[model samples]
Target: MDRLEAMAMLVSSVEEGSLSAAARKLNIPVATLTRNVNDLEALVGTRLLIRTTRKLALTDVGAEYVATAKRILEEVDELERRAAGEFTTPRGELVVASPVQVARLRVLPVVNQFLALYPEIRIRLVQSDRIIDLVDVHADVAIRVGRLRDSSLVATRVGALRVVTVASPTLLDKYGWPETPEDLRELPCVVFDSPSLSPWRYRSQDTGQIYTIADVPRLLVSSPDAAVDAAIDGIGVTFILEHDVHEAVIAGKLKYILQDFEIEPIPVHVVYLSRAAMPAKLRRFIDYAVPKLRELLAEFGRIPSA
Candidate 1:
């Protein structure tokens, strides 16, 4: 048995939580994965995994071995990357993770320019609304919005975004304008349910106090774009990032009503794993992307009327 390959499979199985899941991730058959893992256990003269129908658990020894395996594998990967001159040259695959709408409007343009400048480098952009662990997904960098939790990851602040409440003129005409956040009780609202930003909270500029709107949403949607669409169709008022509705607001399709009560601007950042020796490709991309993104987000963060 190839010990290195088996070790990798074992680690993958532990990380992925199942032999079948690891098999799918590695693009290998489940039987092959199982046999290799079994072989690894035999070679070690001990059982590493406690298997069940629902999940896989590691033995105490297995847990310790897996930890050692991870370190060894990481060292191997680093050595290979060094041998490939990734440390010296800006030539390698760079994985960047970003939100869906931001990827479409903000990040893609910068990526296009970066690719043109560095032909030896290839980029894989993973766009999703869900927040993913960078190390778990093997992403080189991630564009994150809002306040960041305390962690070991390095972050560079790019810009800020206002979360504004907006409604179409037709809807406001029917319901009348809300003079305060409390007035939303009788008005309809389109809520974009998301983990990143909350649309229901508002901050007062004068008092610096946060308040929650108790309005029951007429339309509750998952996607910000869909919520914006619902608001445009006069379904109800919706809260969204200012940039997402800039065009519609300018076109008179949507209007910002409660600017004074808008929540504090959400912070944006470019984040990556903290490392002692960073690869040239990642370093180059951060240098090239940060400034451009800062400029773009600044523009996006601007409220058209306010």
Candidate 2:
């Protein structure tokens, strides 16, 4: 058996979750994928995967091997790029991942401009709110907001985002504006359910104290887009990144409130896995993208009354 080919098949199988899925991604027959994995297990003298009727599970050893195989593949790709003098040309596929709402509202337009400038470079945008494993997902770069706990990855702060309390004009007319954080409990509120079960958090600008709303939400949503829509329809007040709701607020679909007690600005970052030798394509893309993203944020921040 070709050891490298078997290793590739094994990694693909693990990532794709089944031999059939790996075969589909690799453009090979399922039988061939299965055979390669079996050969790989035999050579290693251990079963790498625990096969079940429904899905494949990796053994502890299999998990370790997968990590190693991924690094090996990345190194091999880097070597090939170096051999082809990719460092100078800035031409290759660049895969980026970001939250869907942010990508649609902020990054997509900038991406279009980037593409127009560098026609030779190909781009793939992956929209997901969940934190993706950069290496395993084959993502060249990621745009993230809020506090980053992953110390393993290299991060560059591109800009900051402020959490704004927003509601519709109709809701404000009926319920009246909240004068303080304590007043929020008396009004209906929309809450995002993903990060935490709690309601909006804020700091007292006068007393320099932090507080959280423990009141039950009139509506709970799992996505920011849903929260924004609910607020636009006057369902309830919600908290979202100012950049995400700026346009709606400007158009009178939504209105901003509680400016004095606004949540602290969260840093937006562009993150990537560290390597001794970085690909020119990835480097060029970041260099071109970061400044533009910062400029976009600055422009948004200057929008009066948003």
Model 1 C-alpha lDDT versus the unseen true structure: 0.88
Q: Tell me each candidate's TM-score.
A: 0.89, 0.92
For model 1, the superposed segments whose C-alpha errors exceed 4 Å read 14-29, 44-46, 49-68, 301-306
Pairs in clash, predicted candidate 1:
none
- The residue-by-residue lDDT of candidate 1 on 93-193, one tens digit each, is 99999988888989999999999999999999999888867876778999998778848889999988778889999988899989888888888888888
Per residue, candidate 2 scores C-alpha lDDT tens digits across 184-280 of 7888888877442245788888787778878888898888888889998888988878876887988989887888787667788999988777777
RMSD of 2: 2.1
Report lDDT (CA) for all predictions: 0.88, 0.83
User: Model 1: what TM-score?
Assistant: 0.89
